[model samples]
Target: MNTKAEQTKGASAGDIGKLTLAAVILVAVIVAYTWLGNGNVPQPVRLIGLLVGLVVALAIGAFTGPGRRVRNYIAESQFEMRKVVWPTREETIKTTAIIIAVTIVLSLLLGLIDLILKSVILDWLLKLG
Candidate 1:
């Protein structure tokens, strides 16, 4: 019997192959659409090509067992992502303010040191001249 990890690996490989094939097919479709037309391809045909490619690619993932697993994996991942506890707007603003304040303070301190060093260097240069 195959372990869970092995099954997952096999499914991932199949998904990757399907995606690569889809990308190749999409590129071919785009090239034909562009070259076959006089100037730019019509908007409707382009949209139809995109929709067709999407449907075909998605079908590739649904028709096989590995494809079903890939779909399930995607759905589960989306569900898990929705459960994440994201930072609130207030927290984000507070973090941004703190970062800006620290940056300003450090910039002022560095500017003061740079001015003092420049004055000393100029004085030494004048004495040498």
Candidate 2:
């Protein structure tokens, strides 16, 4: 099985062209939608045209080399995710509670330190004046 890094090697000229065409198709769809909207076209027609353009762009993209690589990567990620040892609900709750408690305690400690420093600095300034 090829690793994710190995699968993402440099794209060929054909792949670049396909990807560019897909982008252009999507941009053209946006332009068309704007133009139609400005020309008072019916909402339904505009929506249909937008949807059709999106589908065409996606289809073109899906046929490109990078798209296939992305699909493969997603499959690999799913496989890896399945192998993960997910925590139980109880464990998750306990971990969350610990994190919250630690954060609260740290914030209080920092606040107290800030208060003390502010009072000390103010007193020193008063003495200088």
Candidate 3:
């Protein structure tokens, strides 16, 4: 029995063509935006053209197989995210307090040891040279 999940089929020629069309639409949108921005086109008209171009590009992309797969992946990710067990406010506060306390204690201990070593090695031993 094949226990693995069925893999998605490879992209067909039609799917490749659809993806190429989507890319072309997006590129055209970018070119239009730049051309409009450089010219004396009105702001509202330019904005409308940009919006229309984006919608057309997205629509084309949505018709492609890869786009459908991407949408499915995003949906699955969101579903998995909803299953996470997030920490409560009280738990977070307690954890933060413990971390801060340990850090302070460790820093004090290390500082004291460093001071003792400096005094012994530099002050006392070096003075005998």
lDDT of each: 0.76, 0.89, 0.88
Can you give the lDDT of residue 50 in candidate 2? 93
Which candidate wins on lDDT? Answer: 2
**Model 2: residue 30 alpha-carbon error in angstroms:** 1.3
**What TM-score would each prediction reach against the true structure?**
0.58, 0.80, 0.65
Tens digits of per-residue lDDT, candidate 1, 47-106, equal 788678777866765766666776777887888889899999999999999999999999
Q: Which pairs of residues collide in candidate 1?
A: none
Question: For residues 1-129, what per-residue lDDT tens digits would candidate 2 score against the true structure?
Answer: 554456546888898898899899999999999988888799999999999999998888888888887787798899888989999999999999999999999999999999998988898876788
Worst 10 residues of 3 by lDDT: 1-10
For residues 48-123, what per-residue lDDT tens digits would candidate 3 score against the true structure? 8888988988888887888887887788888888989999999999999999999999999999999999999999
Query: What's the best-to-worst order under lDDT?
Result: 2, 3, 1
Better of 1 and 3 by TM-score: 3
Collision count for each candidate, in order: 0, 0, 0
